[model samples]
Target: MSKRGKVWLGVAGLVINDEGEWLVVKKSYSGLKGKWSLPAGFVDEGETIDEAVIREIKEETGIDCQVKGLIGFRTGIIRDEISDNMAIFLATPRINQPFVKSERELLACEWRTPKSLVTDHLTSAMLKEMASSTPHETQFCVNETVDPGDIFGYTSYKLFF
Candidate 1:
């Protein structure tokens, strides 16, 4: 069998506005389309995690933010598709305006509370992680060795309380 290889690496942000609501975006593309998630994207070469988060937010929501801390990390496997890992972080928006940057990649943007977010349709793993009140770090591993191409890639997000 051929050796497993690593592929793309991405980063995302969990930016919370001053209203104490988290930012969620509706993707316009396939895979996770119609799903609400934080503003996130790939980490470009020579870019730090914080830089990636800030840049992604600006590109997606037209809002600047400051990275506060890391919430946790996640790793997933895609049997015949893609496997990926991500870093979630906590952040606060620098401005109070709504999302102005509209792109084909995103459909909509809104602010929602953690409690309300849990009730809404969200990624199972993200919902569980948001429900916890404890401040801790955790990592998830997959049973099968994921092919680099099968890996959805790595992303980092900022979480705010």
Candidate 2:
């Protein structure tokens, strides 16, 4: 099929500590303002999914992380904006350190145990989906408009929704 706009492939990482805390961030973007989700972002050209996941974690949280495995994936279509496929990885930090929200687009980075994760706002669908997945295997999910054509209109930064 001839694709009109763009297919954005992104990555997110579930960086865990020995304490079993998972890394998460609040986006500062106008659309995602105050939304809590995994440390994730777009995959730059020529970047591997693994590399993108690690880089996103570092860039957003200021903590170095190593991709442990492909833990999950989530695809979403922002109608007439972009079609997104996000890879979620299991990761570990290179050094014992705290997360510093480095990017101006990041509001905060924190270690939240599963019990500590809140659902009052827009949290990652992957988080809920992850509960049903075994860490030993990969989990995948598809969300957004079912009509593919309506969503593949143009490259977008609408990943926040």
Candidate 3:
């Protein structure tokens, strides 16, 4: 890896409904506009990955959800310089409500069947795989909610298992 490379942490959520449909969105901010994908964004400083995933899902889809566990993650080098790593989380909605897409951040928001998402050409490979598989099948990791004061001097620390 080059010394000039930087790593960016991101989060995505697989928000599943009782009907087994997954929530997804189309980005409106960049060239990726019109492409369907899981609601995802860069993790903000001072925020945990699970918190980031929940926030992203709410901001993009307008549906509140709680993180159940982490299903998986993906890491790759962008242009051989920037390192991109994303954590995929399994979550469920907290209330029965409709999803309102953010006009500035999303082109569309809708529920998609696992098969539909998996077959869609516009969906990314990781998103497709996550949609097609369940958390149990993927061997999910859960936040152990360890105390930061006990483990480290940092104000905030999260350990997953």
TM values, all candidates: 0.72, 0.74, 0.77
Q: By TM-score, is 1 or 3 better?
A: 3
- Clashing pairs counted in every model: 14, 0, 0
* lDDT on C-alpha atoms for all candidate structures: 0.63, 0.68, 0.74
Tens-digit lDDT track of model 1 for 31-146: 55666777777777788877888888888888878999776554554443344556667789876776775686788888877777666655433543554444443233222322
Best by TM-score: 3
RMSD (CA, angstroms), candidate 3: 10.3
Better TM-score candidate (1, 2): 2
Instruction: Residues 1-161, candidate 2: write the lDDT tens digits.
Output: 13435576778898899898888788887444675678888887787889998888888888998888886666665654557677778899999986678778788778877765644335544464454345544333333322223323423322211
The all-Cα superposition gives candidate 2 an RMSD in Å to the true structure of 5.9
Clashes of 1: 14
Winner of 1 and 3 under lDDT? 3
| lDDT assessment of candidate 1 | 0.63
Please list the residue runs of candidate 2 whose C-alpha ends up more than 4 Å from where it truly belongs after superposition.
1-5, 118-122, 131-161
What's the lDDT for residue 36 in model 3?
77
- Rank candidates by lDDT, best first: 3, 2, 1
